[model samples]
Target: MNFSLKRSLTFTIILGIFASCSTSTEEPWSIEGKSDQEVMAIADSLAKTFIMVDGHVDLPYRMNIKGFMITKTVEDVSVETTGNFDFPKSKRGGLDAPFMSIYIPAGYQETGGAKNFADSLIDMVSRLPVTFPTMFAMANTPADIEVNFDQGLISLPMGMENGAPIEDDINNVKYFFDRGIRYITLTHSKDNQISDSSYDTLNTWNGISPFGEQVIAEMNKWGIMVDISHVTDSAAFDALRLTKAPVIASHSSCRRFTPEFERNMPDTLIYALAENGGVIHINFGSTFLSKESRDKFDKMREDLTNYRAENGLSSDDSVYTAYANQYAIDNDVYEDVQKVADHIDHVVSLVGIDYVAFGSDYDGVGDSLPKGLKDVSTYPNLLNELLKRGYTPKEIEKICYKNTFRVWRKVQEVAQGLQ
Candidate 1:
């Protein structure tokens, strides 16, 4: 990747003039408790009191794969059904803004319809408020989320999961921003025209490619927060160094717990990222929350692959599903709600309380979600854990929303200067 001196000089000058973002550590109230029921009740009430912001949620992509379109009424999402999130659950959990992810699978990197696919998901999310006027609204800014919260409505903000949709055009960055995409993860499961992914071995762009660097610069210019969740360590470092504004790892966890996982942030990277004023949102999935869960989960995949190969079973075979379910039951691979708190505590220990938040991958992580936090309604349960850990009400509120809004507002402010 080309790290040109001209770009470096220009970026430094811009950074000098930009105002730093304020992350408030304001604690509105303090709590002291003993009963588990009392603690749980406080958690439920706190959820309603704070403005919660999940950095990423994959509802649009989840709906897309199932050919599920959002209308005035959708069973799984609008009402409480089987999915991890639903309107009723969100209301009960006090989720104010869940950034609806526009996820582009790695296969689209090979084909050429990525942009079209992303637009479709965007449309699906855009229609939520149109169909259910009282329940949802598309949030373009932190101010929008605040207004929506006051109105007792949920904000559906958009963040594209891959930059393949941006393709080779830097102009497309502005195009998506116009369409309400406030952030973009440079790459997904595989490297594309942008950066190399943590999951892919090729390391196509050893770090950010020439184009990836340009993409980050453009994203900074346009106020789109760069997401570094699925990028390799080299790529993560490159983007962290290159961008003029704070970035977010939308749904990543601390690698301190799951040492073998490349997708989560290690101590060094988390330190650097927090130093840059970014926040790492803890994922609620079991595999991301615990190393033991990751180990057992990996073994299950390996065993299932062998079982399927030997039986010549199709991917959709019922027997295959049954075997996978049985394996999960036997291995006991799930973590509980406290594990989520553990990840949050890890981030707090490395960085301060100002840079940690929630980004439950919700409907995206499937059935492998942690036991107590299996769905959106269980956020209060996680909050209950944090309370038990001695988190102040104000500190819990910061994790719930303020840290993310700090980054969100600052990214926009930086864009204003660049323009």
Candidate 2:
């Protein structure tokens, strides 16, 4: 019990306490001023049960087209530090379930595109049990989605972004069902075999194509949720009238906010979606949210396309993005994450909180997200912001994940009824 011995013990105890304190205060990002501990603390204190169900992800191209693999860590897709999503980082940020999109390029819409793309997407998703065993698990049903979240694994649900892959055939929907695709977007950037598109120059189908109606019937029978994100207004209306089950806009915003954007769902359509028991999963893209941002980005893209055509590199695939990034960075074409919350607010005010969800276009449009909501991991920040905006825990839960799952369950019910 000498004084020297007691002093040594006291110093060791103090040092241990300091070390423990430092470890608890580590931050997730070095660039952001807020520490990781601070972010997690705010998230935890809010008590806003955030089961984030991200509605869309283009995994087919990121893996197959780019030959990239998603291991159980962060991936740096390009020279830019803020590009691509990091798994461990996402989990740390509390993103519950992310639906991985198996998107097929529009080239396949003509002949065997639907069957070929559907087959490939199915094969790729089906192999996850063997390929990345520990990292991913498939969720074919709404219940399975929640279960995966409880088990602490990301539920990589399947969503097809274009019916072009289905070609002119309706039976292909059944084939897609067997392949485990739960949802399918009717069109992409261009009008496919099934319908007209919001982004294309085609006036072929003023709304939905003749084949598109057949596709909807087949989708309902097969129990696949129909996604109407990029479809034209006529196509969207046709889908509402044709679909027996609820449909979803996997990633879209209210056109009411931005007047002329065909990509956004107008108030009239929002009313229809809400009445049909569907959800309009808000897109996290900066351009989709802000008209100013969208206009600027589109101009940049057009300039790039013109530049490439003027030069001999029009056919060079790499030239498009090489020019757009510089344009984006130079013009500061980014929206505040609050804009996301604003869209959510608009949806809630229009259709109530039950028909809205998050559909982050991660990897599909990298560097096009709002400020604080850059990657999958930054979801908690969005939740924190939502909390600050006076959203209750229950409302937040519905917005975060429950609403989407509810629609999913309904879609399943309608499918079951067909049989």
Candidate 3:
């Protein structure tokens, strides 16, 4: 060949080699062209390799009501149960640390005994390690969780769902923290001494009460996270401004999807939370995902309320209970797991992947969990859905636990500084 022809051929050969190298260097497990099984395997592998921390799980409260005798070794939580969380499911789903919710009902705030009720729930959680020594351990800090993860034990961190238990005493914050309570949601379904709730009609406090402000300060000093999940927008804003450490919405979703739903955090609050260097762990309830589900569920609840009023029945009446059960069965609606991922996507878009995490609200949301994520074992399915949505493994890891861990570590640091 002539010199010019040989030069052109050489250039073409070099270009072809570069193209081959580029193709070979591409990620093998990216969802772009992989089969469903390949994506699933990738999800499963990621789930197991990383430390998946769900910000909230109400297992202790659920078992407490079931009369399961959690203090004694009744049954293996690692095995399948009728509830949403168990040991086997947790392992399969790769959930390393799930903060056990020590939920105090709103009614307890009025009838008193809120503190006692909280203590009982805490006792139940404390007994888990004793009951199942090999499978579980109590985690007091981010470091505890990592150590527990290394030991192949699930970390059971505690987060009180309402501040009513603290009642009139700011010292209770330190009391509970010493009891291994790492976070405290200011209010639940109704306003209490701490702050107004999203679900209650009363705006008693407008925001955090003076006592509640002291409580937040004490929680910050004690290194306890302040959870803003069920508090009103005003209360949330107050918390965002007052908290010395990063706050978390432990089990809330994006209100953008289900507009007018106060239980979920709004876009403004989410942005503010991100600004505060905190994390929003998405709740996986159907009504929390879509406005349609919320409307349907609200209609059912309204119908039940109307029926009870018309029949002059109390909330505890078996007749009203039966009617409510039938209503739920007749109007059941399930949200696709993709909706949960969509909320995650929205948070990531608004703030970054660093401000979002999983808080699945398992066992607490009853039967309203999204379709593909019905139980603890289904986290991989949600991860697969995210993979398909183009979330990189690093982004997924941040969502899984890193973001929350960072906030948790920050809270600890702030507490040390305050001291």
Which numbered prediction scores highest in lDDT against the true structure? 3
Q: Tell me the TM-score of each prediction against the true structure.
A: 0.89, 0.81, 0.87
| Residue 135, candidate 1: alpha-carbon lDDT | 80
Model 3 per-residue lDDT tens digits across residues 1-419: 44234434644553343344333446433455557886788788778777899999999889788844354454545446788887888899989999999999999988999999999999988887888888889999988988788788899999999999998988899999999999999999999999999999889999999999999999999999999999999999999999999999999999999988899999999999999999999999999999988888778778888898999999889988887877776777668899999999999999988999999999999868877898999999998899888777778879988999999999999999998
Which candidate should be chosen as best, given TM-score against the real structure?
A: 1
Task: Please tell me which model should have the higher TM-score, number 1 or number 3.
Answer: 1
- State each model's CA lDDT, in order: 0.86, 0.75, 0.87
Residue 201 CA error for candidate 3 (Å)? 1.7
**How does candidate 1 score on lDDT?**
0.86
TM-score of 1: 0.89
What does the lDDT come to for candidate 3? 0.87
Sort by lDDT, top down from the best: 3, 1, 2
A best-first ranking of the candidates according to their TM-score comes to: 1, 3, 2
Per-residue C-alpha lDDT of model 1 across residues 160-219, encoded as one tens digit per residue: 999999988889999999999999999999989999999999988798999989999999
Candidate 1 C-alpha error for residue 276, in Å: 0.5
In candidate 3, the residue pairs with backbone N, CA or C atoms under 3 Å apart (3 or more residues apart, or in different chains) clash, namely 77-87, 78-87, 78-88
